[model samples]
Target: MRKILTLILMGVAVFSAGYFFDKYEKNTCRAGVAYSIGNVDQKFNVSEEQLIEVASKSESMWEKAVGRDMFHYDPKAKLAVNLIFDDRQQSAINETKSREKIAALEQSYEGSFKKHESLTDQYKEQAKLYDELLSAYNESLNSYNSLVNYWNNNGGAPDDIYNDLEQKKASLSGQFDNLEIKRNDLNSLAARVNDLGKQLANITSTHNSNVDHYNVQFSAPKRFDQGDFSQNTINIYQFSDINDLTLVMAHEMGHAFGLEHITSSASVMNALMEGQDRSNLAITADDLNAVKIKCGYK
Candidate 1:
């Protein structure tokens, strides 16, 4: 009888322990994951406060979509979200800077090209006017000389005829002065056009050199696993900006929520970052369904 009672007590104790343990686990899981900003490398240049703000926004994306809390922010939480600065992030930054330099060079080149075009047009118009004026001046000079020669051959001219010849000479002199002014203007335009051409050539050379250097430096395609959730921690490897960071954080948080990759490319739980609208980062129907299924939501 004593032996049977001991076995019964042992069985009750085991069952009680197992029941409480299961209940505790269920309650803990219902409470959701607690996370906080962990080690933020100084090289990332982001303060802890800023990271916390970003983390809150990331948390809200999941909670708002599922209509329940999926993550809680606790400063002492073991689930640390760390910003680790490494070659992945460095390469992204370098590529961005290089593209910005190329864009600036392109804009400058375009402006210079347009100015050069405008100056060339002005040169053409000024040259055309100068040529026409020279032709007119030469024609008038020939007529005046012919009249003068005729009067000389006749030994003398009537006063009216002499007066007319003087008037023609004065008019020709004025025309010559006008032609001289136009010639100077045309020459100035030509000089400006030449200078712009040299300027444009220099710009082209510099732009090409920069492009060559960029190609040599960053020709190889790079792939990065921007962020990941492992060992009770989320590590952000690379991101272009705050918006990108938010998406990465949300994706990792989805993993922490016990959700696996979904088939929907637009879902935050997608294994690959494709078709996701980074600007308006939010969970999709698939993501919400996964959350509901995982958390046993009605």
Candidate 2:
């Protein structure tokens, strides 16, 4: 299978190199210089200075991986994100304010619980007083009503209206007391729950949707022997791929470019990965176009 695929890429490269010899005049990409062969919305050459910037970052990343107590692994299903680690950007945006707001709400609820406890205690204390006052008021109100009825039945008494009004006042006083008790009970539970906190938020809001590329070392050098719109995209296999190095880098770069894995074998953006899918290490037209679109190409 490998030999057959190699023959195909070499033949195509020979034909394309012979045809558009002008574009191949100067090669800027070096060993492991990552490139994408997709429908990239934006395409530009990285300056020599920028290339240096990219390459200088590898040393520190490799160091961290070596320093690990143990390589962290997911036991159930192992899938690690690829990246030669980059410098940690600490000056990124912070979300502590939002977390603080959430914590404030939690504190409010905790206070409510405390208030409920206090209210319960108060309610108990006032219950005895309320019962005594309410019972007395009711008994007085009943007596006053009886007197008014007797007065009305017998004849109009001098203090009939005044005494009746006093009985109604006493009844209202008891109602007021009951209302205060109920209000305290409801107020204690009026506050609500909120967010506890966001203590370990490493990624900030600006980078929320940023494309994360993993450290992808190709199984072999990648190359695209043919020329097309996709071929405009470049991948460096140090100019060597026992197989199609461009295709492999382009395909994997499609993943780094943040395109989802898909089913098209003819695509650079195929969901299939090495040791994971059925295909030679190469990018297809679909993979190129998908990335071009994501890169904001028209």
Candidate 3:
């Protein structure tokens, strides 16, 4: 009678364990870890089957560690494997728009340069004209002084010669005044050219900043996993290598299993891997321990 009672209790305990596992699997959607791959198929150059295969392999790593089918494929499951484009593409778009702005500024610069070039030529011509007029005035003044000396040394000077001297001097004085005005205009044109140069420098600086901003955005060479735990969705990006792709899926799926990143390099939950050490892709003893703890497995 004692042996029979022990056997009945053992059978009941085994049945209870099976029932609990079934309930746990159904409640957690572990039986069918339904997922959808995103439309970024072309961007990654991977087929749907390839992506699915990688995800399944990643899932199997965890499932094997727990010694059970923890997750299965379901098309309508809230869990998902999605390919996402990094902000680099948006940064590229921003850079393109910035270039367009610079292009427009360049167009404006061309116009300003042409205007400055024309002004430069005008300034040169005015300067040359001023020099010639000054020389002529000096020569005329010298001739006038000589004539006066001639009159002083000799006798009665012609009234016409003095009149001609005065008229020539007055004409030369007017020309000098006109040249001074042209010089002022040339200075103004030079100031405008300086301002245009400053504008071009500003545009060039802005273009450089846009490029620097893009580089900063894209420099990390890393991937991202986005999941809120509410939707069971995992969005991934920035990984191109097959091994890297598998690593991200496994890591995020581990999160779905309530596993956190451990400090050990032996575990896949190390936050980031260093090299082509595919060993990181597998579930380590520590990882299995974590799953056991999370799932309350003996």
- Cα error, candidate 3, residue 41 (Å): 4.0
Q: What is the lDDT of residue 211 in candidate 1?
A: 88
Model 2, 1-298: lDDT tens digits are: 9999999999999989876653432121111123312221112233434333332232222213223111111223222122211111111111233344445655565665565567556656665666676677678667767876887798776776767676677776777677677556545433311111111122222123221211122233222321112232332322122232234344443333345666764554443323323234333455445544543334
Candidate whose TM-score is highest: 1
What is the per-residue lDDT of model 1 for residues 1-298, given as tens digits with 9 covering 90 to 100? 9999999999999999999977754654588889988889988777899888888898899889888766889988999999999998898799789889889988988998899899898888888888888888899899889989998999988999999999999999999888888888888888888998898888888889988988988765332278889957999988888887888888888877767888777877887766789899998999889877766787
Candidate 2 lowest-lDDT run of ten: 84-93
TM-score per candidate, chains pooled: 0.77, 0.23, 0.44
lDDT of 1 at 33: 85
After superposing candidate 2, which stretches have Cα over 4 Å from the reference? Answer: 1-105, 120-132, 155-298
List lDDT for all candidates, in order.
Answer: 0.84, 0.40, 0.69
Instruction: Please tell me which predicted candidate would have the highest lDDT against the true structure.
Output: 1
Residue clash pairs of candidate 1: none
Residue 280, candidate 1: Cα error in Å is 1.5
Off by over 4 Å in 3: 1-26, 29-32, 87-230
Q: Root-mean-square deviation of each candidate, in angstroms?
A: 5.4, 17.8, 10.7
Better of 2 and 3 by TM-score: 3
True lDDT of residue 92, candidate 1: 75
The residue pairs that clash in candidate 3, if any, are: none
